[model samples]
Target: MLKDFSAQSLFMGLLTAFVGFASSFAVVLQGLRGVGATELEAASGVMALSVAMGVCAILLSLWTRQPVSIAWSTPGAALLVTAGMPQGGFAYAVGAFAVCAVLIVIAGLFKPLGRAVAAIPAPLANAMLAGVILGLCFAPFTAIASDPLLGLPIFVAWAIVAAFKRLYAVPAALAAFVLVMVLGVDLSGDPAGGVISALAPPVAFVLPQFSLAATISIALPLFVVTMASQNIPGIAVLKVNGYEPKPGPLFAVTGGFSFLSAFFGGHAVNLAAITAAMCAGADAHPDPARRYWAAVVAGAGYIVFGLLAGAVTAFVSLAPPILIEAVAGLALIGAFSGSAVAAFKAPETREAAAVTFLITASGISIGGISGAFWGLVAGAAMLMLLRLARKEA
Candidate 1:
């Protein structure tokens, strides 16, 4: 069933994969740091995640015979960096992955939770997604505040590229890179340059040590965040695109992959929403059936890139900070806008969605978990209680 690949489809697939992977590299580094990993160990973790996500994406797409792009959990990675890393070291972190993995597996195996998730109205789900994206988008503006002169040119370049959406569907990050180089922003301070010096053959695998306190404090919350924030929305994206593959199998595959990758110092692996949307969107192929191969291509690319983790890190290091910030901001703009539109569309749900967005944006923490996770819980609880009261009345 393989047809000659279209240049446009290939470009779209690669573009989506690259931006998705690059945007979350910092969080991956944070995951490594949390686990008491050396620089090389951390790089190795990134490599493993890249390889796992890519491979899984390819296999799933090929098997299902649909265009499916697998991506690292951007939100999950953010949670790890913001909460998991600082709370405890690698052993506890691995415990967190293990717990999350187990929960994902259970959810997949159990019919009820899957059905419950499926039963949630599309608008509400979209609203939740919108809230998540809005919080993510704020990072770029904050970066601009940190360095105006350095961030300005990149931001301008991104806006220009984004404005001309059809000429190039490529993410704004690529344009920002071009502008940063032209503007001569200093990048010597970034630690990405030491990648070569840090490179070495993979070390012996570290086994996870379990502790009740660590699991309760770190692992449980991580598991909740990864599932609620990442996995739930991931399935929603697939459904929204009209690809109704069995959620259980997808969850199992991702969880299994995460369990395996944990030994290599990787945090967790899950379905990607925005990046996966790249393959699912009209851009990948006119015939949705053939788009699966694009994911196959992306998967192969991930394997190759993961093998060269040290080299990639070194290259990333050489890039200017402004370039990274600009690219990340630009890449996420569409997702941010789309999510915002989704969040506020229904008057009835507007307040709850707003609450979710604000709490997530506030970046507050309780019990060592992130605000995003709590925000959802709080919003959902508020909605549920209101519903109950309405029914009683």
Candidate 2:
């Protein structure tokens, strides 16, 4: 097992995991809060997701002997922010999350269901996701207006790094945000070193409360985004890297972990796309066979990070809420760009996609359902109408 271990792979693996976590964890925290999680619940949720992904990645890599990276559903987290909480609040959201997890597991176990999920029009999915994140993407500008000193530097750092190393921009901004938070603000009254506690906070359980509105608005859309935005691309990444493990089993494992995590306030965990390439590519190890070590090492690193989730969450709570939101927004700029490009890539669906983006960004809610669900419904309806008109033409 240790034969393929090398310093280079270890470094790369650790780097990939850290970058993945640091870059978007704020979004996860925000998403949890949006769904009405208390500070402790949000912290526990992040910790649960980190541990779930870490454990899943390690077990999958060992079992498959492949560089299988796992990540939280970043897009799904964005969805939560937009969806807000149901009248039933966090418990209802947890129920929806559980439903999504079950759907994913069913998709993995059933070939047709998996194909059906794959068949969701790519443009529509991208458009819906694009719309969901549009508001948060504007946070940096808003932050600057609200608090120039704390926010401007974070935005500047993100912009500068994005201009050079796009992948690391958010992490760079996070570092700057933390620095500003320390130097500019006063943490003197806060707990000195209690951030790193004797143990991570215990996971809080929420009993599932099912509702049609929550299921339709949150569960279904969450499943679609998780599958379309994360899992599909993750499979493609592994395939591009010349490893073709059966995707069905992968979905099953991630879904199972996601299901377990829901009770503890975590969102979906799935195969990773962006970070997968880092571990699966030749850069991890010249010999592809040895590259699995990169994923293994990354998994170990994530576990270590997960152990500090309470500390991270506590620190986040200490920051100005807008500052945290601004940082989260900056973290997702890449996803926003990617989704926008994908949403508009097809000329035929461009109008429909645009409609979706606009409606979702408008944040309209009907019958307690969020704009995201309506955006998908509206866009899909428009696409069909356009197709029918073309047929008649």
TM-score of each: 0.78, 0.64
lDDT (Cα, tens digit) per residue for candidate 1, span 1-393: 556366656766666666566666767776567546677667777888888888888888878887666766655666555453434467666666677677777767887767866765444555555555554466567666877665665566556665776435344456556565556555455457454333443433657767777666556666676676667767766665567767778878888888877777777788776566566655566676666766777777777667777766655655555446455455556656665676678876777777776876676766554565566666777678767877999
Stretches of candidate 2 exceeding 4 Å from the true structure: 112-199, 314-393
What candidate 1 gets wrong by more than 4 Å, as runs, is 65-100, 136-179, 182-190, 193-204, 207-218, 277-298, 320-322, 368-393
Give me the overall lDDT of model 1: 0.65
Compute the lDDT for candidate 2. 0.78
* Native-to-model Cα distance after best TM-score fit, residue 90 in candidate 2, in Å: 1.1
Score each candidate by Cα lDDT: 0.65, 0.78
lDDT for position 272 in model 1: 71
Query: Residue by residue across 1-393, what tens digits does model 2's lDDT show?
Result: 788887657856876676567667878988988988887677678888988889999999989989999999988898889897888788999999999999999878887745644444778767766676677678889989998999999999989987986655666776888799889877754431333333555567778889999999899989988876678667755665667678788898999999999989998999986677668766577788888888888888777777788665455446666776677576556557767887899899999989887987897866444566577678889999999999999
User: What's the lDDT for residue 276 in model 2?
Assistant: 77
Clashes of each: 4, 0
